[model samples]
Target: MDIKTAAALHRLRLASIPEALSFPALLIFGTGFRIAFDYDALVMPLGMLHGVLFVIYVVLLLDVWNRTKWPVKRVAFFFLLAILPFGGLYGDKVLKREEAAGVAAAQAREEGTVDA
Candidate 1:
């Protein structure tokens, strides 16, 4: 892969970190809110918010996976994280570390200090 692809992967990975955190939090809050109160006024809006966040999260996840060619296990792990309660926090940390490494490597490659 070229620097362009590597750079893109860096960007995608960085962008995904926040979504990894926010999406699951929203899911949990919405689910809990619905169960605890069942208020149509709040639940309805929560559902809509969840739907939008879910779509964005999935799109970002798939795009990062496809663009970076992450392995099945890694992708599957992230998919799992999307569901498990509080998983996004861990996922956020993991992605942050990954982003650091990937960005560093991408920079190195661009500088001809690492193999392309």
Candidate 2:
């Protein structure tokens, strides 16, 4: 990938991590707080927050997928991960690994030691 596309994908990937994490966390907290405290006031605000984060996550996911041209399986994996509690941690790890690999490959090309 070109530098611009790669950079954009990286940015999207990074952005997705926090949104993915926050969505589920807010949902869990909202539910727990409602049940434990019998207070529903927090639900609407929390739900709105989660909804916005989820939309951001989906948009970023699509942007990254388009830029990276990842396999459908991988794209689906990320889509599914966004809905699961704590799945963002896993997604972050995967993104980091991919970024490292891309950097290493770029360095290797620069050094005339390309691997196949």
lDDT of 2 by residue, 67-97 (tens): 7899999989988887786786788788877
Best by TM-score: 2
TM-score of 2: 0.78
Task: Give each model's whole-structure lDDT.
Answer: 0.65, 0.77
lDDT tens readout by residue for model 1, 6-52: 55545545544555555456656767877889844665675576566
For lDDT, the strongest prediction is 2
Indicate the worst ten consecutive residues by lDDT in candidate 1. 1-10
lDDT of 2 at 111: 78
Per-residue lDDT, model 1, residue 62, is 80
- Which segments of model 2 are wrong by more than 4 Å? 107-116
**Candidate 1 wrongly placed segments (more than 4 Å):** 1-38
